[model samples]
Target: MYRAHSTVATPSWFSIIAALVAVMLWSAAPLLAALAHTSSPLQLTALTLLAGALATLPLSRSVPMARLSKGWQASVWLGIPLLIFGAVSSYFVGMRLAPAAEAALITYTWPVVFVLLSQWSRLRTLRLSGVIGALIAFSGAALLLLPQALNDGLGGAANGYALALLAACCWALYSWLGQTAPVALTPLLPRLLLVACAIAAAASLLVEGSPKALSSEALLAGIALGLGPYGIAMVAWDKALRLGQASIVGSLAYGVPILAAALLVVAGMSVLDWRLPCAAILVVVGCCSAGRRDG
Candidate 1:
């Protein structure tokens, strides 16, 4: 993804709120998947992507035709389509084996990754606040995720960690490329999601044959995931990137793990503990630092 003119608009309340909306949707993902209990990861992936495609298709027309054409031209050569498929599919499969907190911590690194990639690609430079904030956020992530991983024994989650890393990398690349296209990739989000859906569906067909009949709850859960986290979250993220400073929006995402953990606890799938608040403070401080107007 060659750098385009800097795409991150000035920081704004709309961007911050949009990014926060994406975080909230993402926070619900683990809980939603647990409720769905869709038997096959691949099957679940395909279903959610299909739903995302359907949800985004109607929204595509909202963009002006001229903007859409520009975005499409910039996007076609960016490899964003592959990044989209990789990001969504890997995260779905990885969560099947990873702890909620650990998974959240790992996936949330995309912000830092995005900032670094953006800087390196000349899309944006890493500001001092971004560096300091990234370090602080990662410290918090380590605080939350390290003890848990050690206690659970990393061996059991080896595959999950690998997949999670892949997911993070893919997502960072996707977001960076989106900005590089200077948001020409946005109008194409539906198409990219649809491409991911097609690939996942084909893979599921070959590997698992056909999906098993799902419980009604599971079916509903799948739809909810598609329309919320996998679908609208992507849109919200694009809006955030378009409206906010990249580092700030990316850093704001540090809250995802905290919110996700809280959601799991409320759902009775996890326990509330001291580390949650401590990590929350660190993450919040980091987000504030990164988002400072002067930065």
Candidate 2:
């Protein structure tokens, strides 16, 4: 049975660094979306995946291919690849279709999803605080969607919000499934990413044909996303989670929406909407509450 506990021996400094890395990785989504304005979402996704795979290639060299291949079987290669492809594709498409801030807000709902799923599976007992927090968090999510719901309805930004939620669900499912995988994730990640890259490439070719010429800025942004958020950041995040208190690291995840929204505003991609701050506060508080340890 799963039991909740914190690693008291883990240094605070390392946890802080890991938390910072996670914040950066989370914020990278909207930034990547902003940078992808000139390119097809599919193509951009493909390029970023390819770049991530290439960046991580050296790290995977020492990992035995046979062992890695065995891990793929554990993940049920078909399901894992499909999940990653769906998650990335939906996220990119949602970003393309809606405001970066809104998309980021929607995608950041995965923590709530995780909590709910764990409670549902009896992996963790839901405390009163968790229930209340889930309600507050979901309320914030609803508030974020209100603008689109009122204005364009399902025909416009609603579609993007829906897609973002879909992306969140896919991510949550993948995370849950990863827990039961036969092989540990650290060694499995590089290979999993390679499969994701292949899926993205195939999808891009089918939808967008050959990759077209991109502006210097877009190219740089894509490269940054590949190497930073999708590549090195992932490795750091995994290490941090493994070494740090899960609750503390999970609480830090709530920072993503705020960071992403602020960055988008600074980039002039989004206005400082009143709803954003209010929703962010609620979401962060809710997530923190949900992650609290039961006495």
Candidate 3:
């Protein structure tokens, strides 16, 4: 997705700083999500989306997100919101069964999925080398679930990782479609988030038996999650991608999961072990390999 260097300016210090800040905020998201003990993922998704909508109101005004050259306006009202609602809800749901680190690594598969989807659809041909690299990255995911699958059946134990994969795919599809965006999206963020919130809220009402009230701790964490990762991190990432060498800025994103995993380990929410680091290394290497000469 960061392959479009022509759209970005030369690297700058501010751009790098913005990228790092995105990394930090995003890395803290799961920690906050774990703390946000809602009755269901749908409720959490709605809350975070509502908070994100409020937080990005000023951003929507400051950023230029209208049609730059007008061909097709983005689906700020429907498709985009549906995708985001799916991604966020799935991620929140998946975080329950998997360790924070493992789930974090799983979502990072977005890069790999993004590369492959573009290659398959836009380019209409995927290189054998890229396919092999993608397989290797998928192997890392297998490493993550093998132990649990051994104890339970793959059907039950693999649910979390499967949902995580679904989340990654939804986000990947969103990114792929955005490559030809007729309008900028930065300014429409609030509306986008609000629409997503409505979807989540409706989903919660139907499936989860209505949205329950949040606890004080959950409320605070949800606010922080929205204002930081879902809100500011998104804005910062946009600026960084546009202002810096996109490749360099994107490389920094690979570290977000690692840092998030470390945070979980330090917090005693999870443990750092051979599985996570090795799996992460494989994922990054495979994704980088797949990116090379594929897009």
Candidate 4:
């Protein structure tokens, strides 16, 4: 009995903890960018991906470059499109319509998609508690994002919200693909993927006529976003997933939004009225309690 329990609990706990740390760091990306006063979210995302991809170079020994497959070559190359559409486009377009909190709520809905995919794939069964938890989380999300929905003129905000949610769906696809694909490419894959993404982004900037519009500050912020949050946080996320199952990791990923919110409050970017705290608490409870029935 001791052995049985230990085997299961240990991996779950470890994955959860690792994911918690990863998300916390990952959550800081936007706040730091906001604090840095970045001019363009698209450019920042490009730089972030570039930095993240570059960081993997030194860690090449962990995922040796030689072991990668021909198919993986395509997969590695394909990440450019994902980064551009998912990270760059989503960041710029989503931020325009939705504030960070609203965008994050929609984006983080990947967990629900994850859950549904797991059930559909027969990877795992979903519990009623998890479903209820999702609804509760959604409720908190609505409160967090739609406070002025009626009066604020949903025009672009609604579009942004939809785009962000779509981006989250893309993220779910990314996660799902990971389960099937072994992390066979070296650490270089991520960095290389970023380079690919950068190329794509460069093409985008040229086409969009953003070069003249790009300021020195925006460039720096882009580098920071690429290197710090995009690059470093991804390493953290990779470590977390390397430790164990997706479910536990996804659960712990909930910590990101909370941390982001706290940072927003500290920066005075958002209000900490009674509803905010209450909503945050409810979100925490719902997410943390989703699986506690078995615990």
Best by lDDT: 3
1 versus 2: better lDDT goes to: 2
Give lDDT tens digits, candidate 2, residues 107-225: 77776676667666765567777787788877888887877678777566778888988988888777766664555555656666778878888888988898789888788887777
Candidate 4: regions farther than 4 A off: 1-21, 36-38, 61-76, 79-84, 123-127, 182-188, 199-203, 213-216, 240-252, 282-295
Candidate 4 structure quality by residue, lDDT tens digits, 127-201:
676677667766876776666776676776788788877766666665555554556433554655566566756
Of candidate 4, the 10-residue stretch with the lowest lDDT total is 1-10
lDDT of 1 by residue, 20-65 (tens): 8888898888788767655677778788888888777755644443
Q: Which stretch of 10 consecutive residues in model 2 shows the poorest summed lDDT?
A: 1-10
Per-residue lDDT of 1-295 in model 3, one digit per residue for the tens? Answer: 1223335578999999999998899889878988885547888888889988887787675434453433344454577788889888888888886666787678877878888887888769888767877888888887887877777766643677788889889888777766646556667779889999999999998998956777898888888888888888887888898889887888787777678777878887778788887887888777777777734
Task: Tell me the TM-score of model 2.
Answer: 0.86
What is the model-wide C-alpha lDDT for candidate 1? 0.70
TM-score of each: 0.77, 0.86, 0.89, 0.75
- Per lDDT, what order, best first? 3, 2, 1, 4
RMSD of each: 4.9, 3.7, 3.0, 5.5
Best by TM-score: 3
List the candidate 3 regions with Cα displacement exceeding 4 Å: 1-6, 61-76
Better of 1 and 3 by lDDT: 3
lDDT of 2 at 86: 82
